[model samples]
Target: MSEAATRTVTTPPGLLASLDPLLREWLPRQRWFAGKGRPVTGFSLVAATELLPSTATLGLYHLLVRAHQPLLPGHVGAEQPGDCYQLLIGVREALPPRLAPALIGHVTQGPLAGRTVYEALHDTRPAELLLEALRTQARIGGLRFERDPNREIRSGLVPRLVTAEQSNSSIVYGDTFILKLLRRVVPGINPDLELPLALARAGCPRVPPPTAWLVADPEVPAGAPQPVEPYVLGVLQPFVQGATDGWELALRELAKGEDFVAEARDLGRATAEVHTVLARALPTVTLGHSQLRLMVDGMTERLEAAVHAVPALRPHASGLRSAFTALDDLAAEGHTWTAQRVHGDLHLGQCLRSPAGEWSLIDFEGEPARPLAERRMPQPAVRDVAGMLRSFDYAARSADPPQPEWAERCRAAYCSGYAEAAGRDPRTDPVLLRAYETDKAVYEVLYEARHRPEWLSVPLTAVRRLAASGLT
Candidate 1:
């Protein structure tokens, strides 16, 4: 029997079929699982491979499984069919005491009965093996691991998993290289890898380039229209050792009651530097009347959806609608907007301040919830500016005590710095900036309502500010 065929010892008929019951319960509990609130009706294995052949003691497996959820009536997000997740399962007769937290559960009945299983990432041995596979540029089953020929892959790096509050899984190797393992994946190119490669080629030093990446390209029948999008399995990049996240840095400054204007100003310049490089490297387009109309429509649609999801947004609905409507009017008045590749998701959290006093932008993946195509599409650079502005506001409110004016000061300084670097003032276009800010705040409303109830006031205050302004 083939190694893959024999490795199905986990179950008599099949490995996935046997593990389905267990994963049904366990997948929902995982932080990376995107369909937490929804009920998982069923699961279907898209692909499975035995990375390491089963031995007397261990079996390592990789799986891509589709999780289905019941459709909700009248729900704006109900149309999403399902989400696919990448999993690395490690099986053994028994797990060590140290790996107790990684334990998924024990299989009672299967070809390999009474065996214990857990997330492979938590185990050091499996992490090393995964890195080796990437180093060798190995291809097993439907998963393909490849590395940039220009970068060197060192050996004997200690591997440890980072458990952060993110939508994916990550592993840091010897504090030298960090690899992000995409959990909930979508087809098409992920901006995280695509944008960084472009920036690197363009010689932008403000972001880290990928040293290696893994992709999943399953075969399809000949002449399939719009073939399945390749999932970015994982991304390996140079770790910024001793770099602190911008969010934490901001909080620290606030705690010390020190001015962050200078830091914020520098960050703006860094942002402009990336934006300039991106515009030169990627495709740029002029968004005319039709395009602006489409953008306005999308914002309006999201606003409506947010109002439904977050009841607190009801009172401010009129103002939000007015902001979106103004865009339509601008299009009618024959105004055109320029669109280019931008950091689709930008905030204090998406940046890193190196110990050398340099700022590096990280995680170009855009918003995880948006469609890959939408995230890849060119957008007004103002969108990124708006996101950063919102982050400043958030930092102020989330401090030991609320400091609203602190956010305002930093926000103005950031704008001033951006204008100096980009040679154009974002504040000049009030309508466009307002519209994007409104859209971002609307997104935050739904997010805060769903995830952090105590933080709902942050965005709600923004809503009121926009509402009180007649620019909409």
Candidate 2:
């Protein structure tokens, strides 16, 4: 790692204290903030490095802070910790007209009193500074900006902040590269960077490889044993120009009432190819009786929790419980299943279609709400298959009149395509497939009931159908 000659400056004392009031009001309103509907009690600074010194006219500070919040309804006794977030805060004596919208608030006390703070990514200079650091592999204090030695990044690509409604923030660099900044971060090797690198090394072209990435060294005690791994902050990858997200493409086709079977089939093939490579690139495990029992137990636990959270799911609870226990019944017969690393949150939105009709999968971050270890765990590929299948159902149901026939055709086509590429159709394992699908629907039910009451009908419709099928 190359170190820049610029002297590193420490964060001003009491900076966080002064910003707490402003953040408590601003953080929850952000689309990327995870602690929605919960009050931010306080914050503890994990690591703070002055990217650009406070003495400068335009100062930039990189912060990793843990936001403390109240425990969930049932997790009071559990060891639940707050979420750590990555922030780029810019400080200026006065705001420019262009940066007015990015303002976080004006500090009234402490080191930065009377100065304005705003999101740094919205400013051109700060965004350029990040790219230059990555291009040069510069190590600034605890932050390490590294790039692929083989890939040459040209200097000075214009930066544009992506305004998409997502769990994270992004910045596109002159249509050549895109940087995805993870807001709610954890201390581990994030799968977003880990899996794509593995696929790239295995010669899989279905996913884009990261060209640059940011890592934060652990802030261990002076005499304590050093941590084994650093926290992954962000990833930079080649931007697929002229690409349309699968969700948008599907909606467009559905609005026209056009057949999407061909695209759905090809998407299945793409998914299978990625899965095949992942199995070869990573270690695979066979889940036997004990493992299957544990998995079924987790499913049952989640179902009970969902039922408690959303009373509407109570009627389907019996049927869903049966779907989960059916796995246990098979385990009793000496049945086993293969588990490998997979895209934990596979859905239409995670896929992209190029202008030439080529498909590419992005965002290996998995379910952001899940623990990093759990998200990285090896799972039955049918889990991903079930996610896509549910995505098709979602698209169909989201239509004006609800296109059940279209969804069925797409689902069958997708399975056929998977069988062709994988040599084993997921439909062949009816018991496992139904179990995973049931688990996904239960999750959706809770999510919709809590976040979008109007959209509750979408997943409820699936719960009704799956329950009627008896999940046998």
**lDDT values of the candidates?**
0.87, 0.91
True-vs-predicted CA distance for residue 327, candidate 1, Å: 2.0
Error of 2 at 252 (Å): 0.5
lDDT of 1 by residue, 1-472 (tens): 1243222223235677667778888999999888778888788776677776655577888888899897666667654578889999998889999999898888877654688889999999889988877887777767777888889989899999997777788999999999999888887899999999999888899999899998987666579886777789899999999999999999999999999999999999999999999999999999888999899999999999889888889988998889878878988899988899999999999999999999999889999888888999999999999999999999999987899999999999999888888999899998899999999999999989988899999999999999767542
Q: In model 2, what lDDT does residue 402 have?
A: 93
Clashes of each: 0, 0
Best-fitting candidate, measured by lDDT? 2
lDDT (Cα, tens digit) per residue for candidate 2, span 1-472:
5445334557778989999999999898998888788899999998999988777899999999999988877675633478999999999999999999899999999999989999999999999999998998888888888888988888989999998888999999999999999999998989999999999989999998889999998578678776646889999999999999999999999999999999999999999999999999999999999999989999999999999889898888898888888889998899999999999999999999999998999999999998899999999999999999999999999999999899999999999988899999999998899899999999999999888888899888888887767744
Give the local distance difference test score of model 2.
0.91
Candidate 1 Cα errors over 4 Å, as ranges? 1-13, 75-80, 221-227
- In angstroms, the error of model 1 at 392 is 0.9
Query: In lDDT terms, how accurate is model 1?
Result: 0.87
> Cα RMSD for candidate 1?
3.2
